[model samples]
Structures are given as structure tokens and as C-alpha cells.
Target: MALVEQLNRDMKQAMKNKEKDRLAVIRMVKASMQNESIKLGNKNLSEDEELTVLSKELKQRKDSLQEFKEAGRDDLVDKLETEIDIIESYMPRQLTDEELEQVVKATIREVNASSKQDMGKVMSTIMPKVKGKADGARINKLVQKHLS
Candidate 1:
């Protein structure tokens, strides 16, 4: 099933199970997806666009969790963690460290990137291949490691 379709079904199940936190996260995801669609002139979002939205949502929650932790707000941190978990459930499985390194090395070779100066060339070539499967920060680190 498509992600949106699965989200709709999960929303209904959340309501049925009286899962307030889970329901709230699902509603937030649906709203974000809708907003993205509207931004694209009311067209349905492509899978890539949908994955981008999901990743953005997850990133926001992670950032919030850090802030909440620093402020000593365990309640909010817990909620944010839960939301992160829910959002991540919809994302593609992330690459392992070794797998990411292998990909970065392959991309560098493919782009003929030999030094740190070629970082941009390597990143541009690799990002599309790993989109929705690897974190941009992690990819950047791997690229830098291989280039330097």
C-alpha cells in the first residue's frame, strides 16, 4: 500500500484503539503531507516527495527532543521520541555504517573524486542514490572520510 493509504489506515486504527499520542502524530503527518501537496499546486505528492516530508518531520522531532532534554523537560522529550518512532516507521530502512561507507566509496570512484576539493561533486552524485535511506549528515561525513 502507498504510504498515504497506510497512514490513513493507521489513523483509523489509532482512533479505534484510543491511542492519543499515536493519533496525534498520525494527524500531524497527514497535515504535513496535505500542506506539501498544496504547495505543489494541489497535486498528489510523489513517493520521493512523501519520503522527504517524512524525513523532515523526523528531523524536526529529533531537534525538539534535544531542546527538551536540555531544558529538563522529560515529558516533552518522551512525546517527541514517540513521535519520532512513529514517523520513522514509515521511512525506508536506514543504511548501516559499513553499507554507507561502501556506497560513499563507490560514489567517489564513480565521480572520479580524488580530494577534499571534489567533495561537492561526490556528494551531488551520491545523495540521489541514497536519498530517504541515509541521513545527509552521515553521508557527508562518509564522503569527507573517503575524500580526505
Candidate 2:
């Protein structure tokens, strides 16, 4: 099913289950999608666009989670963690370490990436292939390790 449809179904389920937090997250995701669509001349977002939005939302939550952890704000940390989990649920299945490593290695060769100086070349070439399948930091570390 499409992202919007899935969100709609989950929203209804959350409402019926009286899951306020989950429902709120779902509504927020849906709103973000709608806003993006509106930004693009009111056209529906493509699958890639949906993934981009979901990834952005997940990244924001994760960044906040990290900051809240440093600040010793347990309450906000818990909330951000929950939101991250919810956002992640909408993302594509992530690549395992082995799988991601393989892709990174292959792309490194594909781009003729040699030293750390070529990190940008490898990253730009690999990111589109991995997209939502892998976290960029993980890929960067893997690429660095292999290049070393």
C-alpha cells in the first residue's frame, strides 16, 4: 500500500485503540506528507518523496533524542525515542551491516574512490543507491574503514 493509505489505516487503528501518543505521531506524519504535497504544487508525493519526508522526520527525532540525552532530560528523551520508533516504522527496511558494507565496498570501487579525500565522491554515489535502506553515518564509517 501507499504511504498515505497505510498512515490512514494506522491512524484509525490508533484512534480506536485510544493510543493518544501513537495517534499524534501518525497525524503529524500525515500532516508532513500533506504539507510537502502542497509545496509541490498540490501534487501527490512520489514514493521517493515519501521516503525523503519520513527520513527527514526520523533524523529530526534522532537528533533531538541525542540532545535530550546530553541534557539529562529523561522525559523528553523518552518522548523522542517513542517518536523515533514510530517514524522508523514508516521507513523502508534497513540494510544489515554486512549488506551495507558490501554495497559500500562496491560503490567505492565503482567510483574509483581511493583515500579519505574521495569520501564525498563515494558518498554521493552510494547514498542514492542506499537511500532509506541505510543510515548515512553508518555508511560513511563503513566506507572510511574500507578505504583505510
Candidate 3:
């Protein structure tokens, strides 16, 4: 089933099961996906597009968790972390550090990049492969380490 359809089915199941937290996260995902679909002037979103939406939502949760932690608001941080886990359930398995390192090395070699000056080229080439599987900040760090 499509992401939206899957979300709809899950929403009904959550309601029946009285799963408050799961329902909330699923509702948020539905709203975000609908908003993106409308923004793009389309009625349906491809699986890849849905993944992009989920990725953005997960990133927002991560940012919120970081800010909450920095401000010493453990309560909110705890809630955001829960939501992050819920959101990530719909995403593909994340790449391991070793796997990410391998890709970065191969990408750098493909782009013939030996310095920071070629960072953009290497990143642009590799991001599509890594987008939903790994965090961009991690990728940047690995790229820098390999380049220098």
C-alpha cells in the first residue's frame, strides 16, 4: 500500500487500540505528507517522496530533542525522543558507520576529490544514495575525515 494509505490504516488501528502516542505521531505524519502533496500540486506521493517527508519530520524531532536537552527540559526531550522513535519506525534501516564510511570512500574516489575544494561535488553525488539511510552531519564528518 502507499504511504498515505498505510498511514490511514494504522490511524484506524491506533484509534481502536487507544494508542495515544502512536496515534499522534501517525496523525502528524499524515498531515505532513498531505501538506507536501498539496505543495507539489499532486494528489498522490511516490514512496520516495513519502520517505523524504518522513526524513524531514525525523530531522525536526532530532532538532527539537537537541534544543530541549540544551535547555535542560528533560520532559520535552523525552517526549521528542519517543516521537523520533515512532517516526523512524516507518523509515528504512539506517546504515551502519562502517557502511557509510565505505560509501564515502567510494564516492570520493569516483569524484576524484582529494581536498575540501571538491567537497560539494562529492556530497552532491553521494547524497541521493545516503539521504534516508544516514544523517547529513555524519556524512559531512566522514567526508571531511576522508578528504583530509
Candidate 4:
């Protein structure tokens, strides 16, 4: 099923099960997707676009979790961790280190990225291929490692 359709179905299930925390996270995700759709003039988002939205939400939750940890708010940290886990269920399986390195190597070869100066070129070429499957920071580090 499409991401939006899956979200709707899961939302209903959450409501049926009276999972308040899970339901709240689902609603937040749906709202963010709708906002992105509105920003794009109300067009239905493609799967890639939906994944982008999901990834953005996950990133926000992770950042919040980090801040909460630093501030010693274990309660909020746990809540955010739950939300992050819920969001992650909808994302593509993350790439393993070996897989990521292979992709980076292939991209480096494809783009003829010889040094750090070609990091931008290599990243631009590889990101679309790995989008929603790998973290940008991780990809950047791998790219830098290969290039340098």
C-alpha cells in the first residue's frame, strides 16, 4: 500500500486499540504529510516524497531526543524515543556500513571523484540513489573517506 494509505490504516488500528501515544505519532505524521502536500499546491505526494516527509519527522524526533537527554529529561526522552520508533517503521530499511561503503565506492568511481574537492559532485550523484535508505551525515562521512 502507498505510505499515506498505510498511515490511514494504521491510524484506524491505533484508534481501535486505544494506543494514545502511537495514535498521536501517526496523527503528527499525517499532519506533516498534509502540510507538505499543501506546500506543493495540494498534489498527492509520490512515495519518494512521502518518504522524505517521514525522514524529516524522524530527524526532528531524534534531534529532540538528543536535547532531552542533555537536559536530563528522561521522561521526554522516552516519549521521543517511542515516537522515533513509530516513524522508523515506515522508513526503508537503513543501509548497513558495508552496503553504504560499497555504494560510496561505486559512486566515487562513477563520478570520478578523485579527492576531497569532488565531494560535492560525488554526494550529489549518490544521494538520490540512497535517499531514504541512509543518513546524510553517514553518507557524507563515507564519501569523504573514499574521496580523501
Candidate 5:
């Protein structure tokens, strides 16, 4: 089934089970996905597009977790972690570090990125390959390390 259809079914199940937190997170994801469809001026989003939405949601929660920790708000940090868990449930399994390294190396070669100045070239080529599986910032760091 398509992601939207799966999400619709899950939402109904959540409502039936009275899973408040899970239902709220799923509803937020649905809203985000709808907003993206509106922006794209399209009636349907591909699986890749849906993954992008889930990835963005997970990233936001991670950032919030960091900020909450920095502020010493353990309660908020825990909440953000829970949110991250819920959001990540919709994403594909993440790439292992070794797998990510291999992908970055292959991308560097494909792009013919030979110098640090070619970082941008390498990143743009690698991102889509790693999207939803690896964090963008981690990809950038790995690219920089390899290129340097």
C-alpha cells in the first residue's frame, strides 16, 4: 500500500486504541505530508517524497532533543526522544556507519570530486543516495574527512 494509505489506516487504528501520543505524532506527520503535497502542486507523493517528510520530522525532533539537553530540561529531552522514536518508525532502517562510508566513497568517485573545494559537488551527488538512511550532517562530515 502507498504511504498515505498506510498512514490513514494507522491513524484509524490509533483512534480505536486511544493511543494519544502515537495518534498525535501520526496526525502531525499527515499534516506535514499534506502541506508538502500542496507545495508540490501534485495530487500524489511518491514513496521517496514520503520518506523525506519522515526524515525531516525525525531531524527536527533530534535537534529539539539536543536543545532540551543543553538547557538541562531532562523532561523535555525525554519527550523529544519519544517523539523521535515515533517519527522514525515511518522511515526506512538507517544505514550502518560502514555502509554510509562506502556510499560516500562511491559518490566521491562518481562525482570526480578530487579536492576539498569539490565538497559541494560530492554532497549533492551523495545526498539522494543516503537520504532517509543517513543524517545529512554526518554525510557532510564523512565527505569532508574523505576529501581532506
Candidate 6:
């Protein structure tokens, strides 16, 4: 099923099961996607657009999670961890380090990137291929390591 449809089904299931936390997370994702759709002046988002919203939401939660951890807010940290887990459940399986490295290597070769100087070129070419499959920072670090 499409991501949105899946979210809808899961949302209903959460409601029926009286899973407040899970329902809240599903609603949050649905709302984010809806808002993105409106922002683009469209009624529906394409799968890629849906993935973008999911990735963006996941990234925001993760960034917030880091800050919450640094602040030693154990109370908020646990809640955010649960939220992160819920959000991640809707995302595509993350790339394994070896798989990500292989993609980076192939892209480097494809782009003829001899050094970190071609970072932008390599990154632009590779990101679409690995979108939502790998973290940008992880890819950037891997590219830098391979190049240097």
C-alpha cells in the first residue's frame, strides 16, 4: 500500500485498539503530509513527496531527541525515543553501512570524483539514489573518508 494509505489504515487500527501514543504519532505524520500537500497547492503528495515529509519529520524528532538528551531531560527523552521509534516504523529500511559504502563508492566512480573537491557533485548525484535510505551526514562522512 501507499504510505498515506498505510498510515490511514494504521491510524484507524490504533484508534480501535485505543493506542493513544501510536494514534498520535500516525496523526502527526498524516498532518505533516497534509500540510506539505497544501503548501505545494496540491491535494495529494506523490510517493516521493510523502517520503520527503516522513524523512523531514523523522529528522526533526531526531534533532530534538539529541538536544533533549544533552539537556538531561530524561522525562522528555524517553517520550521522544518512543516517538522516534514510531516514526521510524513508517520509514523504509535504513541502509546497512556496507551497502551505503558500496553506493558511495559507485557514485564516486560514476562521478569521477578524485578528491573531496567534488563533494557537491558526488553528493547531488548520489542523494536521489539513496534518498531516505541513508542519512545525509552518514553519506557525507563516508564520501569524505573514501575520497581522502
* Candidate 3 segments exceeding 4 Å error: none
Cα-based lDDT at residue 50, candidate 1: 94
Model 6: which ten-residue window has the lowest total lDDT? 1-10
Q: What TM-scores do the predictions have? A: 0.95, 0.95, 0.96, 0.97, 0.94, 0.97
Question: Residue by residue across 80-125, what tens digits does model 6's lDDT show?
Answer: 8999899888888999999999999999999999988999999999
Predicted structure 1: lDDT: 0.91
**Could you tell me how far off, in angstroms, the CA of residue 22 lies in candidate 4 after the best superposition?**
0.6
Residues 95-139, candidate 4: write the lDDT tens digits.
999999999999999988899999999989998999899999999
| Runs off by more than 4 Å, candidate 5 | none
Total backbone collisions, model 2: 0
Q: Which run of 10 residues does model 5 get worst, by summed lDDT?
A: 78-87
TM-score of 6: 0.97
Report the Cα lDDT for candidate 4: 0.92
Q: Please identify model 4 stretches exceeding 4 Å from their true place.
A: none
Taking every candidate in turn, the Cα RMSD to the unseen true structure, in Å, is 1.2, 1.2, 1.0, 1.0, 1.3, 1.0
Per-residue CA lDDT of model 3 for 1-148, tens digit only, reads 3777878898999999999999999999999998999999998888888999999999999988888999999999888988998899888899999999999999999999999999999999999988799999999999999988
Clash total of candidate 4: 0
Location of the lowest summed lDDT over 10 successive residues in candidate 4: 40-49
Off by over 4 Å in 6: none
Which ten contiguous residues of candidate 1 have the minimum total lDDT? 39-48
Model 2 clash pairs are: none
